[model samples]
Target: MTDRPERDALRPRLSGGLTVEVIETSALGDRSYVASDGEVAVVVDPQRDIDRVLAAAGRLGGRIGLVLETHVHNDYVSGGLELSRLTGADYGVSAKDDPPFPHRALDDGDIIDVSPRLRIRAVATPGHTFHHLSYVLEGSEGPVGVFTGGSLLYGTTGRTDLLGEHHSEELARHQHTSVRKLGDLLPDGAHIWPTHGFGSFCSASPAEGDASTIGEQKSANPAFTLAEHEFVEQTLAGLDAYPAYYAHMGVRNIAGPEPLDLRAPTHADPEELRRRLDGGEWVVDLRSRKAFVKSHLAGTVSLGLDGPMVTWLGWMIDWGAPLTLLGETADEVAEAQRELARIGIDRLAAAATGTPDELAADRAQLTSIPVATFTDLAAAFDSGGSGGGGGSATDGELPAPDVVLDVRTRSEFGDSHVRSAVHVPLYEVTQRAGEVPHGTVWVHCGSGYRAAAAASLLARAGRDVVLIDDSFDNAAEAGVPLES
Candidate 1:
């Protein structure tokens, strides 16, 4: 579910005496909560940005008293350690992880009092991870809401694939039981607050709505409606590929993540950029995919600023490698940096704001790639076409590519794709690019966003590339030969 909150306020208030202020990180489309009862504030699943969580608590007339994490997160870094150090709050991490940082190892059934009238009781909901915990915010009357991190979501549960591919089926069955347990324990009237439903790729199934209640889910959620075996099968089939960075988050979180530092992005001249690029360093361009495909600096890669920039950046770029960013403005660079910080990518070699003229001062260095409609390439292939130089043979200037590189995910490619298309997912293209025979390579995604990125990478590797800048929905209508 996509939440449309005001510029500063949290959305969909949970019904209770507790003041629940949501700090939804819209860049990653994930939610964190600040719940206070006039005196003590309890923060849940905070991102690396801790100032906003503190500010939200202050606005509600309370100081932060506790930091809580429901599990070892697989999406982004948890700010619990940093937030706890700065605020002197007791940090709650699941006991099973045995986190290295100073924290209270929160266990199932443990109750932490927030105020005279408010308490948070932890419930063992081990579906998201092996030791996941869900907290039920309790008032004088009873339960108010359950902060179900990734265990039990509005319509589904967290993906079990994160643990290991081998454990997925086992975990899926466990998730079903855990979800049912939450519905059994929490009151029907209690509200459901999940941290992953927005755009976080943690859920096993799609998040159905903005919010739902324990009673509502009990009546409608798969845990209640479908047979346990059917629910497991449906969930396993529904799981999609998560970002590659997810593989490292659990280990990083256990080691203890560093607090975010907006390492000042310094200005670098064209010469410095050239030296870095020549030395095999990365220059990530933060522009619209459209702008990038139209014009970009030679040897630079495109992972546009507006989409899932951080996820791709973290996935594709080597953690130890020196990286620089190029954006049209300082604000654009900073915006990309902020999102990167959530995943604990706190530093960059440098950040520069550049213009086309500066990049193209040396005429041969001016880079521009064209978009291909699916049909144009289809017809070329219909007449025994493989790509010539990654560009159109139809366009006389470049060599034709031998491969039609479809940069969409494996799952997307599996459902439906052109019969001639080769699958090299956008993130893994860097390592796998050498496998493609020398020719013009056609690259595309469901949308054109990642197509620009894929083409840029292949071009940087000296492969002739074309960006298929059309929607995938047009494939069948365009008379392309498709295979499932």
Candidate 2:
């Protein structure tokens, strides 16, 4: 088992007797918070990992009195139901959400007194979702802080397109009004505690900083600085594709996600691993990209633990596809299992731990891909090594790539990219693999991680691939042509 440390909790002291402890899930780019007043606590927008929330509350020496959902999350399964069941806390969800669970239905303007000193007032803040609510933490003096779930983030608001493109414009307008409402409802000194926008895709754009207050946001946030139409226009224009796994999250949350199962999965022998691979199950290698590029079993995909493994794997795999994990140690596999469970991938088909040689039937089953830097790529392209005319090169020399596949995001591709690279974002690689030009394909992304994953996918699709294992910043420095 992995001897992983507990999730880091950032405890920020609020006015009055309250203190807010932040439980961050950095992998998912989201946060859950526990607001405690010495004796009782409230948990807001927790990820499926309930243990982190419990640990935070325990550290604060407070009993959990309430579990609150800001909205029906589109990114991850909520642990609210399970947490409430375990702690006997009143689970508070928006009344309009009508989730199929027993809880205290919260409406706009409803106030719940946790003690004589601390009270939570629910305020309707629509836009990220139709029924989103922001909870204001009120002390005897006035409001101290507000938990802005997906409504008002650090610098930007939550993306309005998660519901669907049809409602995007309307929601964007609503989002503008909602953010302004918060600014007007609270004093400038009230601290702003938001759930999304700390590198989360849920944010309309990238978030600016780690912390802020209403006064800080009023000076910098677009909703406060820009006109309503301008804010809506910019917000809608910034929309991009989110993870495909998000489709399952809202449905699961509304239906009430089952408790997480973190027990070790069944162990698979070499023969069983081969059989599963041959039968088209996803056999993911959870090694470093360098190790994966050096050697892996044929037909297995590389989703190195060094990268956004959970996000990319969940994005690329079929929802119910049987998944088998390969790692160097039991601890590595356990860590991956915990990460997967956060995104509602609670069960693994099987797992194997060892070198590729040990997991393969023979040395013949092991294969390695060519790894190249941007400098090598530049030299190859400059030497008249272009696509379509290739016999496989002998020895370790890569044949000039037939195609340079840019597997970065659309926004990244739009900003600047290799002059002649074909754009196919990593998430769309499986469905659009056929469109890639034939011959040896060179794959690259912002960093080597996505490129390695794309290279593996291209290899799995029966194409010869060279993994560009270097940073994109080196492209120009290494003399690879770039076009904006």
Candidate 3:
């Protein structure tokens, strides 16, 4: 049973007939309530934290009859169906073509009373995703607000480049129409509620500022201000490459997610770790960059073992490679497993006891590389020389290898790099390894995790490999050259 916060605790009621409540449910999702004459509640989008939404339902003291999703989300797994299961609410989605959820499909003009107090009217907004919809919430005074989803932000709009199958032209066309429609139909006082705010890559603009009125959005939003064609082209220009896991998220949301039980955490022993490693597994060190730099297992990359560990790991690490965790402690290992399972990256073969123990147990498998300081990495790249992939020794030291193989994301790789290094991101490394000439190759990434994994794979393939041991800071301080 979950403890329900006081109804008043959710949020102080706004002036209009509808009272607004915001529940800070999870790092990725949130829940809202608008209590009025009909006792209605509209759940915007939910993440893993289902209990909070349930509690909000309890606080409302009536049935939660409606759910509105702005667009298909990618950052955090959507628990839309689960919310429906817990509360017998009707799900309303904007996507007409791909109605993945079991709920009723909504289009341009559909309006429904989510609860006695809250009424939602759908407005088609397609720039973020082809079938994306925004909701106009009506209260006693009038249309009280708009749940923008990814479409119209305070000063900007959602990216049109995400869904590749849906032609940009179609999305852009719908987006233009939606923006115009929203500006025309919505009252200036309509509240603008957006899904992705700070820390989200979904929108081009930063999620900073108090909630704005429709009038403010019309004057400020670039898409709303521009003519249709220009708005479409400008929106496409700044979109960063979508994270690789986005494809998986799309399918999972459509088919309903396999229920997750976060109680059990996964970990592995050295021998088991070695076995998985031999079988093309990735060793992820779930310690902070600071903790990892102190001394972690030689080959493990440092992706913190906290919430969203698995999501970001999947985004950053090569998914094809199964994972072995090197956590800070027994608890950390379990935490890593649970978090990873949220996104279904459950390939943890075993938990490592510690770095020294693993290395001591398997001497033959332990290969060490001279770690570089952050300074070294930056200076080398700045000087038009190779960075991590071990550079040639300038003085009496051994020369850095001929080629540097960096397998981080394009964004990460582009931020800084060693000169002349061929970039084959870790996810694509194994398949593209054959293209990487056999030589004394050195591997390095933000922390050591990916580089170590790549090096291990290469060495196993009868190729000479080395790794950089220093963490991000020490590398920069050590004058490690940076490309960008």
Model 1 residue-pair collision total: 18
Best by lDDT: 2
TM-score winner: 2
Ranking of models by lDDT: 2, 1, 3
In model 1, the Cα lDDT at residue 351 comes to 82
- Candidate 2, residue 428: Cα displacement in angstroms equals 1.1
Q: Which structure is stronger by TM-score: 2 or 3? A: 2
Candidate 1: deviation at residue 4, Å?
A: 6.9
Please provide, for model 3 over 166-233, each residue's C-alpha lDDT reduced to its tens digit, 9 standing for 90 to 100: 46666766777777778899878777777665345566545555467778877777767888888777
lDDT digits (tens) for residues 316-384 of candidate 1: 888767888898888888878878878877778888886756754465667888677877777667556
| Native-to-model Cα distance after best TM-score fit, residue 77 in candidate 1, in Å | 1.5
Q: Estimated TM-score per prediction?
A: 0.91, 0.96, 0.74
Query: How far off is residue 326 in model 3, in Å?
Result: 3.9
Q: Rank the candidates by TM-score, best first.
A: 2, 1, 3
On the 0 to 100 scale, the lDDT of residue 284 in model 1 is: 90
